[model samples]
Target: MRRSKNRGFGIALGVAIGTSVGVAVNQVAVSIAIGIVVGLIFGSILDKRSQQQEK
Candidate 1:
């Protein structure tokens, strides 16, 4: 449950950051897509680490 929440938060945070960067670079769509991918990767890594720590 907590892991899911973290993943969601990461994605949301990515969106926000991506939007800002996109606006600066004039590539909103591409930035958002990249952001989502990066967020997912980071989120999954975090989840894995958390799970490991729980053991």
Candidate 2:
């Protein structure tokens, strides 16, 4: 449950960052897509680390 929350937060943060990058590059759509993928990856990494700590 806690891991899921972290993932959600990561996704939101990624979107925010993606939006900004998109604006800078004038590619909102592409940036958002990339952001989502990156966010998911980051979220999973975080989840793994947290799990390790818990153990």
Candidate 3:
């Protein structure tokens, strides 16, 4: 399946960061949650920027 351009960066980055933190702290779930939230913030910012560029 094709990846989504809008969300791909944030999600990938989030997961990577999250997994790293989680593994380091031994709190997989919490780390993943934090990562996902951060990723969503990043994704939203990116998406808004892209939309602005298109206009």
Error of 1 at 13 (Å): 1.6
lDDT of 3 by residue, 1-55 (tens): 1225657788779978998999999999998888888888888888888778879
Per-residue lDDT for 11-46 in model 2, tens only? Answer: 888888999999999999998998888888889989
Candidate 3: which pairs clash? none
TM for every model, in the order presented, reads 0.83, 0.89, 0.78
Model 1: how far residue 21 lies from native, Å: 1.0
The top-ranked prediction according to TM-score is: 2
Off by over 4 Å in 2: none
Tell me the number of clashing residue pairs for each predicted model: 0, 0, 0
Report lDDT (Cα) of residue 46, candidate 2. 90
Which candidate has the top score in lDDT? Answer: 2
lDDT of each candidate versus the true structure: 0.87, 0.88, 0.82
User: Cα miss at 27, model 2 (Å)?
Assistant: 0.8
Model 1: per-residue Cα lDDT over 14-49, one tens digit each: 888898999999999988998898788878988988
Please identify model 3 stretches exceeding 4 Å from their true place.
1-4
